[model samples]
Target: MAGIGFELRKYLNDDSFTGTLKAYGFAGLISAGPWVLSIVGVMLIGIVALTQPVVGEADGSGVRQFTTSVTWLMGASLVLTGLLQLVFTRFVADRLYEMQDTIVNANLFGAMALTTAVSAAIGLILALTLFSQSFAYEFLMLANFVTLGNIWIVVIFVAGLKRFKLILYAFALGYGATIVLSILLLPFGLSGLLAGLLIGHALLLFLMVGVVLPEYPVTLTVRFDFLQRRLIFPSLIAIGFFYNLGIWIDKILFWLNPGTSEAMIGPLRTSLIYDLPIFLAYLSIIPGMAVFLLRIETDFAEAYDGFFEAVRGNATLQEIELLGNHMVSAVREGLFQIVRVQGATILILYLLGPTIIGWLGISEQYVHLYYINLVGVGAQVLMLAVLNVLFYLDKLRDALLLTSTMLLSNASLTWLTLQLGPQYYGYGFGLSMTLTAFLGIILLSREMDNIEFKTFMRSRPAQEVAA
Candidate 1:
């Protein structure tokens, strides 16, 4: 992504209105397009399903079953894959840096294969034992879950390599087919819809596989090098798991709490009051994501590279320190830019909360939660930027601490809020992110302030003999 930003800078250099749009447009596509398009695609499917009415639904009165199933699939898959996603990402980075590019694709295949088996086993257990649905529904659900897990792995692989154009086209075809096949299959009932989802994502999986295949044609042999103890960072695994768990723990509590949720299917449940606002608030992060991509990748990345390069090249302390200051300034400016953009977005949403809720006809009661969660996820972008910088600097301990704090805080506070009352419904998750961001910013500031010592006095390179 940092590399791709240079190409985006080319458009911004045009310095025209159209050029500016092109730059941000490309950035947004790279940052927000996948999830945004996915959400929209699901909404489209729901709207179309509305036309014919939900057929074969157990309740026959609500449309929660299909959506709930989809939700569970997404939530479970993300958390499950979270363990390896960051670890694998780091492996790829190290391999690329070492110019061992041949093994990258083979390792991805290995990872995908492992992910598929794990997700399938989990899905089968849930489908067979816990969830009581028809055989077709269960099978399709399990298949979708496995396919979606593979998709996440491939997506991270491609997106990390900064294949922006391929990402755009791939998502376009994939989701386009999904929507079309879903609509076409809608008439066949929920089973048909599930089949559509399965086929569409399967198409997407194949497309992504095809895209990366040529890049590493050395061997597709199943290699578990990533799992080797020496190369794997347990802290990274913990960080990934904790970060994703923190994000979803609030919603999970909401869905499972006896008072807040109602059983939907088998043990699965839904929190009508808590679900809408947060998902919608995620869409609001587009502007902040765009800004994050542009600033962190372009401005901050250049400064970061310069500082490191100066260090390795034996530059004067003054020159190295100057570049360090530039890097610090870049991170500060980037974070401040996100705050400005996302802040403005939140303010606008807060003001129009009522109007938007009224427009959606979901009840004006959601307006409060909407406003709170907007700020919450807004803070998420800020926290994520901080984490990215820490990861780049190899401050894994600090990164793990922050993410662990996030998980603990969000889980405890959200549960506490639930116990308090509906009035405090969204306060917990929102506040947790704000608190994490606040702490992360402080940590980053301290690191930047100590840049000189960290570079010169801290741990020396492995091959260097300390004085």
Candidate 2:
């Protein structure tokens, strides 16, 4: 998102209220637009289903099944491709840095092909063996799963480029088609909805590829040289895996726990008590994410580059430390801003949450859970910002440890909450994130204080070798 952030920050040049609004609005849309479309679009489809069920069923069984299938599809895709997300991003960044442009497009195709093969193989296994659904449903789902995974990889590439408007347009058109086609096909039941999804995503994938592939010349041979031993960053791989796992582990625990969840489909269980509130709470993070992408990508990135550039150049100790201090302050201020922004958003949501839940026909009983998850989501955003800063600093070990902590704490504490009963349900996720974010802040502060020493010391061996 460094590329996206750089483009968005140009709005700040105005330094007016309108400018700030533009910056945030664009950021929110760019960052979370797809999310808004998915949530709201699915809800609309559900509403349509509620009003009139198909000929066979009185209830919106099709809608429920469709939603469940999609939920699982997204979960499986993200977790399956988690390692590639960071590792490939790092590969592209390095190749770009080294001015090896020709390597990028082919490697990207290689990655997409790799992601498709893996996701398809696993998806086919699960779709065939685990699911007892009709062949059409399974085939549609397998296709959608493969497309979504490929889309995720393309997003990583296009996000690194500055094609913000094109990205938004592809998202809008593809999802727009999804909603229209899904509603039109709703009468056909689950397979139809899934078919709608497959088409929309296929188009979206094509458009996304257009944005990226046209820019770089295509190389004849597909390359998987990125998987070579020297190019791999195991710490980054672990960080991506653990972080993605950590975020989902609590939800998985809830779903698999017999006490909390019931079977939704073959091998898939869902916790009605736990799922809705957390999903809604995630929507509340758009503002924080917008702010997050801005500060981290712009201010913190600038400071980071300055400090490192100063070190690599002929800057003296005093000069380097002064820039280091700037970088430290950037980190402090950025984290604080995220907290303040997300805190306000949380408070507003708290006051209005009951009404919102009522509007959605959700039980008022889930209100407390929603509020708790709100804070958890906020803490996760803060953790994400911290992780981004850590990544920029190349503090991969710290990142890996923090992600591991989140996974362990969320899993264990969530299990404890289940034992403690309904009132404590959402506390586990909230508390885990809060604990991790606070720990991250402390670690970051300490790391910033000693970065210069470590930077110079680490370089000393290379310096000696050169001499």
Candidate 3:
């Protein structure tokens, strides 16, 4: 027993065996930290303030309504962020790849400031127009909250920064402060929660700007070459727009159609409450996003090294074969690792699902939603891995095309599922996406094979791989 226990402890602690665990832990802290606190605040503050004893609704109508609204808002936010990311990520990646100091200082910082201003303005307008009249205070608070959230988008550009460790620590501190602040303020009610969120993000924005912008000052003289490079801007915008639409179609439908009240947990019911399950699924993304970002630097380092090695010299047939094999293996391993981590997480969540939700004061219906979201997450992860590899190979056009196709498929499938019914749509969306992703993988794999052959035949000066 002692020997077995010792072996189990070693397996648990080994870094390679537990890399995903550590990665997930880091991701969860940064990504889900704020949202988790928000949920807790909702339970303690919002539920308690509703001033009614919990009872199941007469019909299942309210659930759909709540689901729709939450999904729509979430989906819209997703689309907005995705579009912003598409433009910014590509631009930063290009400038950083060339080690261009002027572009980093001027173009990057300028773009970020411009983007934040535009996003904040839009959020402010939405808050004023939709919310100002009735819920004046809440609306203003929401506006501030969203403005802060949009500003946080700037943090993504840190992807290109050389000093990731310091940047990550900064984010950790920002998130930690946000969590503590949100919790401390929850006692004052929803307004307090909203105010805490506003302050927290405001602080984060300041922290990021202080850490990042001074490192790369914008140049006054604009390079025509740099301006022309903005040709990729359209691709970025399209990518964001479509991806956002695809993610939020179902959510919008639910929001548009809030139905009658239904049981949320055993006997506890609420009208159209969608936030809980969505929040749970969001927990996965918080960690996933963190892992993806953390790995981005390492991936680039490793990918570029391998890429130059394969292209540097006239590849012997053996070298060609090895490269091809490596490409396939890399894709498989990256995806497999994500799957293993996600599966373990799902299992842990499953075993403790009821107890955990109960403790959080979340409704029982969320249990099934949690499972459905996991399935969606798995499909999304696999698709994301495949896309990254495509980008690595510089098949930008093909990658763009695949992403476009997936976006269309996601939107159409999700919309169609809503017509079938609400409870069915979430799961249906996942199933459809899983199918679509499988098709995408097949197409991308073929494209990769073709690209590899053509690159092997071309005679270009190959870059050397670092040890």
Candidate 4:
């Protein structure tokens, strides 16, 4: 992501207001491209379905079901891949640092293969048990799950490659194909829609794999050396899982709650009170994400590297202290920028809530939920920035602790809010994230203050550690 940031910074060489805007705008598009495109593709499918006169009222229900199925598949696949994404990223980064390129490709293939097999088995079992009435739907569902899981694995590697433009193009192509194919296949209904998605994702997986494969030395041998190696941090895996789990926990609670949720398909449920508003609110985070990548990658990262480089060069303590202060300042400014930008975005969206909802043809009754959810998602961006700082400081335990708190808090508070009724619907997610962000800010501040001492202590030789 920092690499993407660096690339984007080139666009700001002139430093004019328009240039800065262009830089960040492009950065946001590249950063949020894949998920935003997916959302658009799905929404287009729904819109097309709703417009079809021959389908009548059933079209709306079918569109809802299709949307729910696709959303569920994406959420579930993300949870599964989250367990491995960070750990694999760590492993790959370590290998690259050591110039062990051959094993990187081999291990990546091994990971994707493992994920595909597991996803396939799970998808098959679920299809068999849940969708017995329609074999075509079951097959399409299974294919989508497997393809999407593999695509995530491929995407992680591609992201590491830092070819932001190429990645953006690939996503555009894939989702473009999906939208077109889905419209063409709409007459076949949900299965056809899903088939379009599966095919599109399969193409995406191919393109990403192509981008990733050429970087490594040609090797056919599969290696699960990462699994065998103890170099991976357990906390990294925990943080990845907990963080993603935290993000979705509130939604899950709402989905399963009898008062808020209604059955969508085969034991799947949707929370009418929670889902749409939150999803729309999340789309507003693109600018914040762009700024986050820029500030962290360019400003904070350079400061971090400079501080360490100065240390390595045996610079004076005063110089090191100055560098450390610079790093801290960079981080603070970065976080503040993210908050300010996202806060403004939230405000803008809040003010336009009615207009947007009216345009979408959704009830104005959802406006309150949308406003609250916007705040929650903004806090989530802040929390993520804090966690990124922790990662830079090698505070995996702190990151894990914060994410765990977020998960537990979201789940418990959401359940409580459900019991409290509809007026409190979005407060659980908003309050939980706000609380976690507050804690994260405090922890991050303390960690930055003592970062030098901690880094020195951790870097001492093993024999010196005995002393």
Cα lDDT listed for each candidate: 0.85, 0.82, 0.54, 0.83
Candidate 3 lDDT over 77-193, as tens digits, reads: 556667666566566566655676556656555555555566567666766566433363445344553544454456666533544444455655555665566456545544454
Best-to-worst order by TM-score is: 1, 4, 2, 3
Candidate 4 Cα errors over 4 Å, as ranges: 1-7, 53-59, 459-467
Best by lDDT: 1
Which pairs of residues collide in candidate 1? none
Candidate 3: which stretches are off by over 4 Å? Answer: 1-78, 134-146, 149-152, 162-168, 179-189, 217-230, 260-273, 284-304, 313-317, 351-367, 456-467
Kindly list the per-residue Cα lDDT of model 1 for residues 1-467, writing each as its tens digit: 44586678898999999998888888888788887888887777777776675553444433566777788878888889889898898888877777788888889989999999999988888777788878888889889999989988888788776686687678778888988998888777888888888888898889988888887656858788899887787988999899989999999999999998888867889887888888999999888988988998678978988998898898999998889889999999999999998999899988988888888777676678988999999999999999989887888889999999999999999999999998899999999999999999988888888697787767745412111
For all candidates, what are the clash counts? 0, 0, 17, 0
Per-candidate TM-scores read 0.95, 0.93, 0.72, 0.94
In model 4, pairs of residues that clash are none
In candidate 1, stretches whose alpha carbon ends up further than 4 angstroms from where it belongs are 1-3, 54-62, 460-467
The 10 consecutive residues of candidate 3 with the worst lDDT sum are 48-57
**In terms of TM-score, how similar is model 1 to the real structure?**
0.95
Error of 2 at 299 (Å): 1.4
